[model samples]
Target: MQKKSGLRGIHAGWYAVVCVLVLGLVALVLYGSGAYDSWRDGRSLDQACDGALAQDGLTSALGSSHLKAEDGDDGSLAGCFVKTSPGTGRAVRVTLRWSTDGAPSGSLVWYNADTLGVREQAAPLGNGWSGVVRYDGTWQIMVALDCANQKNKALVAYGDLYGASSGTALTGLGRVTTETAKKAAAQHGCQVKAGKRLTRVSTARLGEPGTAKPLGQAQGSCVALRDVPGAQSGTPEIMEYPADPDAPQTNCYLATSAKKPGYGLYAYYGAAAKDFESVGFGHPGGDYVLATAPCPRSTHEAAFALYRLYDRDTGNYPVPHYSDSFARSALKAFAEHEAEQRGCGEVRIMSAP
Candidate 1:
């Protein structure tokens, strides 16, 4: 009888253990399923925010007259525009926004448009947020929804929609007032005024490179020059085409001496008909000579030839002057001219000195 009692007690203990395990499994399953509903609600909110952000980007683009709305998939949100400038080449700016609502836990992610990968993530903002993105030669502006309770993520993606513009930097003043934000949005469109000034000669030094003249004395039509302090050694070497075996190509070598090599400027010119034929500067029936040379090193170096082959028969001559104070102006003018010749409308200038 005592042995029977011991067996019964052991069986009761095992039954209690099994009951606890079954209850724990049930609890786990309930929590997992219950959490999904909340996730779905959050995801719905995220989709709404994405739509709103997309509208904002489109409104900014259309209202500013920078782009026309293109046909897209139903419920899809995207917009873009093309811009052109005399100095800067062509570029397109686009904006895109998307979201995920089903994840229960709130999360926001920022992505680089080119890679389409997350660049940042955090809790959603209460009102909205914006980011600037660059891919290839394009620039994008992205804005997203600021969720109140859950993490609602939105994005404003801008593409380099138009040709290049003078000012390349995309500034984010973070959390600006609606009016200010609207102005910034308008800026992304073609209606946005151009803020970058092209390279020009100093008014006071219009005809005088060596002399320090009054600020207003320089010419307004001058080209922008690039500063190459160690160009003799550090400057990129110029590459020449096979047709023009004797023509100087764009080349730069760093100066090895302690004393920097005096600045070497180039005067770009379109050769005359015979000269063009002799050096292969121009094709058959082309009137302009495509040539560049080191500018004469002088304090008073005032003028450099600027030429453009408009067509086989016509060419343009825009004289780009040089000034010590406006050294970059000439370089910019020449670079622009080169871009135009190459049929490139946009150019990027790095801020590195």
Candidate 2:
């Protein structure tokens, strides 16, 4: 009986030793896989933008669980440089800036891209967010949030990726911009119309002659511009957003050839309109014509412009001059059509200077 009892005690001691060893192994695995580090570094990136940039799903997109921020400032603009782990072969570097005047205050040529690629038409990020995204080799996003009391200004979050990227990375960038804009608006005491959580966005990057159709068969975006002169001529194409009035800005690019853009029409409402006029963009002159109409969303009038297309190399207007008379007629038609779509009244087209 004594020997049997001793054997039972020995077996219990061995069982306890095995349990401890197994637990130690499990802990070693967790630590080695960096699961512990992930928890520690999870909220690190949020510190830069005043807790505006959410780190959720960014780790997977960036392919690193570790991130750091180098905070910066430029005049009134708040900026940040976000990077992946220090020594990773595949790294992502994103620079973000936000301010009331971050967007272009004045430019007839507003088709801009941060990355090194041909500029393509940007698509609107729907789901109640007033923003547009363009992807070339890299991506750029701009979100304009309207203020309730400060009608003349808006909080704009603009950001672009600098290095390696993927579809997930694009979505992650959108998340960063959206979250930062919302947080900044709140901090500045702007009762802004908040956007919903961004789950998905369009990746379409259409270049010249986008979504083309014969002018005779014009519909959708080109329908409003169909009555312009030479509608029955060589293939003309257009690119535009779907009829959406709540959007703060609208773009329409009309191309007379398959190779190049012909005319660029733009509408700026609310804060964007203010930004446009503040920098002498909406002034009637140059190779472009201007128009204005009152909009419900803005305390001031919305501004529109029709710019003549030119060759980048020579900086000269296209051959045949495309006619100034044609430009005026086209501007009037496009302005009236766009104003009507936005529920605005009486577009007052300005004479060319």
Candidate 3:
């Protein structure tokens, strides 16, 4: 009887050990799975949250506000308002949408994106991209992204940031905007990263028809002249936020050469020069011996200078004789281009001195 009892005890001990081992294996598997999920969550947060939380950056961009997205508008717009507190009224809202069809045209995208690129490079983050997008009435930050390895879709962020003019505020909203994009990156396969780059305006000037390549579009930049030693080149400079804020004043110098003993060209911006018809460009009235003309109904000015008062090499010049015709042609083409791109009104020609 004593031997049977000891045998039963030994069997029970073995069973206990077996059960312990099985439970240990199960716990290990669960822990491993949980650990893997945690890792994935961290990575996912990096894409959307990391860049948005730069408190000390130049823009002092919007940090993690714990925003939650609900169903967006019915018209291809998926957006969420950043509430002041959970389940309460909202303060700021950031929203985004992507579309393959009915997307903004490439040139239109280029026109609007060019300005924002200058305004905000890192706003809050970069998606490995270089441009932005815009719509009518309100100014917003936009980006072009590729979804699902196919060349498709654009990302547009609009903050109802009306009457707000702080750079901090602008970029703060921008950060939220990009964070929203990162959250969608995985679902849409927004494979391409984004960054900022200035839109390049082509340097080629107006030449004879069919001979010279057309100049690249300059949205908010001044296509004016900056002199180098050997040959003339186009120097484009950002003149305020023309496209983004739609600043009223802007100019484009069609052509320019070096100082005296060289050649030169000039253009009028949003300046109104009177006495141009009576006094003329070369007359003793204004600076640069530059011809002036009324822009008529358009608030923007019009005029171009080929051989201003102080031009040198007056003897062996390439384009000689009254270049008014030249200025007219260049100005006409530029005005037309602006109308086509920006819907600027007619630039009726007035007389030159």
Candidate 4:
């Protein structure tokens, strides 16, 4: 009987030991099968959250008053706000970058209170890249990844910035102001207007047909020679004459009319002293005149002459003369002035006559 009892106890002990060992094996199998690794592999949520939080901290450090972040798919992050940097006025800037391994590719999208649309992405720079879409008006930006190989993936980062009204990134404000002033002067009649109609003249003092001559000699005693204002700059007004005797004669004469106190330096021409008479005396006929008046300076005089010469040679008025050296110089000055007036960078002259 004693032996049977001892045997039963030992059997019970063995059974208990076997049960404990089986339970330990089950636990080991469960642990090894990755029940915990599923959660570990899915820890991308924690990484994304941490990234967003870190970006917020960085933006705050940069003096951004309003900072916000949002999580996106595949380890992407985005943020936006108004920056407090001085001189930046109500401006918006956006940036996006993404990376991928092997054949990595990604995309970015943005929307504001005004417009919502997918913007075109620029080529990536460095490991990741940043770009600005619009700076002056409303803002939008997008980034993308090149996933050439399906095995590769990407992480996208995006940021938007708004600020106060800052001036343009270009230069030359002074030039623009000066040009505007000049235009205003012209409009106000601070300069003389070019003649709309010409007078014909006939006289001996005038040079032969098709020949250019001095106006002071052509007009003689009929009109007094007077220094025209705005001539100091070498842009003297010229008077042109026809060399033909039988053709309607004309004398070149500078206009002294100054409604706004400006002057036109001009030259006159005639066939004979008598032809010069009508022009100087404001006669109805017998004078031929070509004139350029009320320009900024004499540098443009040669250009004007070349323009007329080109027209005469080509049988076309206002012939374009950009290739000519004289025209180019004048055009350069004009372009600079224009750029100054329009508040733009260096003005480029595409074509001129």
**Top TM-score: which candidate number?**
2
Candidate 3 TM-score, true structure as reference: 0.34
Writing each residue's lDDT as its tens digit, candidate 1 over 1-353 gives 99999999999999999999988888777677765444443343234322222223222222232222222222324333322211233333333323331211111111111011111111111122222222233333333322222222222232333432223222211111122223333433312111112121111210113322221222211112223342223222221111111111121111112212112222212211112223222121211112232222111111222121121122321112223323343344544544453333443332211
- Could you estimate the TM-score for every candidate? 0.22, 0.73, 0.34, 0.19
lDDT of 4 by residue, 1-353 (tens): 99999999999999999999999998788779865444442343234333222222222223343322224333223322323233234322222222321111211111110011111111111112211122223222222222223222222223233432212211111111122222322333344211111111111121123333332343321122223233223322233332211111112322111101111111211111112222332221211122222212111111111122211223432222223443344334333332232233533333332
Candidate 3 lDDT score relative to the true structure? 0.36
Which candidate model has the greater TM-score, 1 or 4? 1
Poorest stretch of ten by lDDT in candidate 4: 111-120
Residue 100 shift from truth in candidate 1, angstroms: 1.1
Model 4 superposed RMSD (Cα) = 28.4
Candidate-wise lDDT, in order: 0.27, 0.64, 0.36, 0.26
What TM-score does candidate 4 get on C-alpha atoms? 0.19
TM value for model 2: 0.73
Clash number for candidate 3: 11
lDDT of 1 at 67: 23
Off by over 4 Å in 4: 1-132, 145-154, 165-353
Which of the two, 2 or 3, has more TM-score? Answer: 2
- Per-residue error for 114 in candidate 2, Å, reads 15
